[model samples]
Target: MESVFTILVLLTTVGLSGFVTRVIALKLPLPLIQILLGCVLAWPGFSLHVTFDPEFFMMLFIPPLLFADAWRIPKREFFRQRGAILALALGLALVTVPVIGYSVHALIPAIPLSVAFALAAVLAPTDAVALSGIAGKGAIPSNLRHILEGEALMNDASGLVALRFAIAAAMTGVFSLRHAFLSFVMIAVGGLAIGAAIGWLSIVLSSWFKKRASDEDPAAGVIMMLLLPFAAYLSAERAGCSGILAAVAAGMMMNYQSLRADMSIVTRLRIRGTWGMIEFVFNGMTFILLGLQLPHIIGSALIAAEAQGYTHMVVLIGYVLLVLMMLHLLRFGWMWGLRWLARRRRQRNATDLAVSGWRPLIIMTLGGVRGAVTLAGALSLPILLPDGMPFPGREMAIFIASGTILCSLLVAIVGLPMVLHGVSGKEDGLAAEERYARIEAAQAAIRALAETHDQIKVGLDESATVRVADCFARVMDLYRRHLEVLGADQTADEMARLDDQVDIKLRTRGLQAQRAELLRLRRRQKINDETLNKLLAEIDLAEAALFTRSRTV
Candidate 1:
């Protein structure tokens, strides 16, 4: 194990996992697989010599992963399901900590209340990325997915905040109700404010840099965009605010502001590719880390059991599992009851409401698996308490936290697929939606083209109008062909070829507009050459948005 290279082994695992996932359609969750792999690596003869710094692990991995999730979740869905999201993020975490704390203290009497609470806090929330990948495989409703994702995204921050407060209490040997309450409020509010401010600044800075770029090197503006999230997060953290929230806010702000008109197709492609890779690697590594830690966590527990006077760690493990089961049951019961109430209310009011089915709600609750953040918080537990004594039950607490997380991951990865299967497998609704969107877009495009042609016919001289009308007819025919392609009236090959031609024509027209603007500005001397470049970039971004919308349709 010492002779073998660690990085090479981890990378090999990642590559193998991906291959297994794609080739065999391995139905198991990737994280579960990764954790299993780690356990195997750590077992007796094959013990892969690996060590991780707690702070480095948390700071390096958590921020980017959380930020990416936040960035992808839409504002509309986030707000719509905010109540549920908050319930899970803040409210549920508060409930979970105490429940786990009480259960742990009862089952393992030697573990101090403070240490138990700290461990409880660590296992409070599940990993969103894991849930999404698992739940997304099923034909769950998009709105339900949004709620789960949003909740997962926000709860991670909330869980970390709780963990910090619990750690503070454990270290200082004092817990103040007022102080803890205030601290929670301050961290959440301050983090939000700072995140927003940083995000806005990043947008402004990125926009300014983009405007200053030369035509010969459009890619120069890209570097500023890449730096924005990191700068925003680090700066906010330095200013005594939550870096996680700050990173999320910056990513969300960039998603809204920078994705607008003026973004080149090339830029959009680059941004998507960059973020996709970031998300993939981060998720992959997280799973691997969790897997690697499993053997260590179990080994530590076994060693500590003798000193702690606990003969059956398995009994304690079972108790932890029971607590988790109860929490999930509570979640399911709440979701089901709330939805039933909502349905009744809608019926009484004679109002139409889109009810998110129960399957997703159930899956969402079960999906909570503790991840790297939990491990980080657990590891960060102080070596000593305020009285100069070793932190009570530190090793036992770590074992329990790690065990609960592993158990949660196992349950989620295995159970989610089964849960998804029972959910409505109907893609008809989404297919219908896609069809409707395409028809509407096609009709709207036709009307716009018709309107433009009408204006041209009216403005032109009688002789030129005929020739122009002929050109207009050709454009109309092309538009009709587009509609046919969308309607699936055209062959797939023909549609593909025509779609390429349509994109080329659109790009050509955009270029023509830029040329026209440049010529007009040069003649008048009212606008500088720089203005043309800026305006053209803006136009390109706008065009790219339209293209993106079309593709989605």
Candidate 2:
């Protein structure tokens, strides 16, 4: 808890410094700035020491972060680009370990190969949130963007699994390929099964509660929702499966299932906003914490390994940069080869090849900053061997991994913007136009519905129809505004603005109606609780759908 407070204060300072730097037009990556700040604070006397703990860090951070990221990745895109994602997430990670291990062994001959392998594994996984700045810049095409995001999400799981195997082999003094392979399969599949079960049960529980409850308490429902990820993850791990994979699977499943549930537009908006803020804070703190850990690790290593002195440190830093560059080069080379083959196949089939945008691939590779998970894994390394001696090269290995993270962040921030500039000209204006066209189509549908309602009201008796006519008139006004905004070039923005206004109006009107109806029911003393609850649920569902549709578009 003290550490958490320290982290919050340090992060707040880091954020302010980053803002100051940006305001003055400095061009460093935010992560880099945070790392430097961490270093400065850790210098003796500043006293911002964070004692890294394995279990606490993993439990507090990884699951929710992974789940949130997986939930938002477009399921359709993930499937479509599954092959590329697999190659990078799984294949590239396998390639990275041995390559990085050998390179580090050559650079630091004193370090054991197992320790080097562990370090390599730590640095292999990419942090998806670290790329938010690049992605938010809107420099990549939709296809490439989705593919990059999918790759990041999948590789997080893949990398963690690989790291675990490497760690287990290091600790047990045995590395069985057969066991490792079987373990990976079991963890992944078992986690998936666990996640599915949790998702199913959650839905059942929520439905049961919704059916029997009389107060219509959505807060209770939201509480149940928060428990699913943690429950699925912890339960799977307790059952000898990957908690990381379980959390991801559960989140993905929940995101899919929740689409059909009854929710008010207000609730959805509130939830989205809440999750977005959570993710942002988590990401910012994760990077800052990673940065904060570096100076201490590196300084400690320098003191412990006195044989080679600062020269060794300098050489190791160079090696870390080499390994970092190699990571990017391999990913880029793999993507290039894959795209070339894809293009050849498309030509053979007389079909247009999907554009393999370079900027996104660049962003993806460079954005691979080893963060909280890597640090957590590194700290999890056994402190002592079976012979009662300290784990060989553990401190030095952590230093190298931390240094690699810094190098990766620097490269990404500096290189991504240039790549984006080179490729921004190729954006598909035609696609944007098509999206605008769809907005018009939806607006037209709404307007047509309003018009039909107006015509139907015209044929009714004036006394009986006046109230219904008034409703249609209000609805017609809404549709007219929507239609007017549809064909505009800023259609997405315009629709979003209109949708917000509608949500506000719906909330105000729905609450007023509910209050009035409740009074009427109380006066008559004849309202069935079940019927009244069902009506409320229906209103909530309609309100939810309005926001969902608007946002989805």
Best by lDDT: 1
Model 2: clashing residue pairs?
A: none
Against the true structure, what is every candidate's RMSD?
Answer: 8.4, 7.1
Predicted candidate 1 versus true structure: per-residue lDDT over 1-553, tens digit per residue: 4436887787787778776766665566666776677777776786576776677776777777777677777786687677666766777778778887887788778888877888878777667777666555445556567666776777766777777878887787689879887877777777777777877876677678768766635455556665666776677668776777777777777677656797776777777778787777778777787777777777776776656667577666776677668667766765665566667666422211125655566666676666767777777788787788898888777776777677777787677677776566445766787778877877888899889888888867989999988888887775565566666545764765567567766876876687687779777997887887787766767676656645643
Q: How far is candidate 1 from the true structure (C-alpha RMSD, Å)?
A: 8.4
| TM value for model 2 | 0.80
Structural similarity to truth (TM-score) of each candidate: 0.78, 0.80
- lDDT string, candidate 2, 259-345, tens digits: 865755545655677777776666666666776677778767677556767686677677777877777787777766666876877
Weakest 10 consecutive residues of candidate 1 by summed lDDT: 347-356
Per-residue lDDT for 84 in model 1? Answer: 66
The alpha-carbon lDDT assigned to residue 459 of candidate 2 equals 68
TM-score of 1: 0.78
